[model samples]
Target: MAVVNKNQLLDFLENRVEGHLQEAIRVFQNERAEILLQPAPDGGWSIAQCLEHLNGYGKFYLPQINKGLNQANRSSNSEIFKGSWLGTYFTRMMEPTTGTKKYKAFKNHIPAPDLDAPAVVAEFIHQQEELIVYLKQARQENVDAIKIPLSISKWVKLKLGDVFQFLIAHNERHLLQAKRNLKNLEVADKS
Candidate 1:
C-alpha cells in the first residue's frame, strides 16, 4: 500500500465505500426484490446474497475495530500509515484485478436463499456508514500499530491500517460481484 496522510486515506476509503452504497441504492430503486434475489446463471450468489455476505463481515469487523480503537493507547499518531506485509497481501488478494480466486464464506457469512433483499441492502449501507466513523477514529490513533484480528482465525491479527485496506478492498470486490449478478439477471431476462 502507498503511504498517504490520514485524511487522504479516509477520503479514499469513504469514496470507495460510499460508491458501493450509492450503487446498491440505485439498483434497489430500479430493481424489484425478485431481481435482486435472482441467482446468476453460473450458480453463483445473487445481489442480496452478496450484500448479506458483506453485512456478515461488517457485523464482526465494525465492532472489533471500535473496541480496538477504544482500548488502544493514544501516545503516538503517525501521519503516514505503513501497511503490514501480510495485510497488504490479503488486501491484494481481495482485489477484483486478482482474477477469480474465490474463497468459501465460512458458513455463517452465507445468506439464506430466502433473504430479504431490501433489509440486506439497508444493512450494507449502515455498515459502510459505520466504517466511515471507524476511519475517523483511526485518524486520531497510531493505526499502524494497533492490531485487529482476522475473521478467518482469531489467532491471526493484522495492523489497523491493513485491516481497513483489506475490508475496503473486500467491499469493492463483493459490490462488483453484486453488480455483475444484477447484470446477469438482466441478460437472463432477455432470454
Candidate 2:
C-alpha cells in the first residue's frame, strides 16, 4: 500500500462517507418501494438488497471500529499511514472501478429478497452518519497503531486506516451497483 499523510486519507474517506450519505438521502430515500425492490436487468440484487448487504457489514464493523478507536492512544505528532499487503489487497479488491470481478458475500451478509425498502434505506443513511463520526474521531488517534479485527476472522487484523479504506471501498462498490440497478429500472420503465 502507498504511504500517505494520515489526515489526507481520513479527509478523503470522510468525503466518501458524505457522498454516500447524500446519495442515500437524495436518491434512495425518494425512491418508491417497487423501484427499490426491483432487480437489475441481469437479475442481480435489488437496490434494497444492496443497501441491506452494506447494513449487515455495518452491524459487524461499526462497533469493532468504535472499540478500536476508543482503545487507540492519541498521537502527539502527525503520522503516515502505510497499509499491510493483505489490507492493500482487500481494499483494491473492493474498489468499484478496479475490476469486473464479482465477489460473493458471506452467507450471513446476503440480504433477503423481500426487504422493506424504506427501512433498509433508513438504516444505510444512519450507518453513513455513524461512519462520519468515526472518521472524525480517528483524526485524534494513531491510525497506524490501532488494529481492527476482520469480520471474517478474529486472528486477522488490519490497521485502522486500512479498515476504513476497505470498508469505504466496499460501500462504494455496492452503492455503484445499486445505482446501476436504478438506471436499469428506469430504462425498463421507459420501454
Q: At residue 167, what lDDT does model 2 achieve? A: 94
Best by lDDT: 2
Local accuracy of candidate 1 as per-residue lDDT tens digits, 115-184: 8887888888888888888888888898888899999899999988889988989888988888888787
lDDT of each: 0.84, 0.92
TM-score of each: 0.92, 0.96
Worst 10 residues of 1 by lDDT: 23-32
Whole-model alpha-carbon lDDT for candidate 2: 0.92
Q: Write the per-residue lDDT of candidate 2 for residues 76-146, one digit (tens) a residue.
A: 43568888899989998999778459998898898999999999999999999999999999998888888
In model 2, the Cα lDDT at residue 166 comes to 93
State candidate 2's TM-score. 0.96
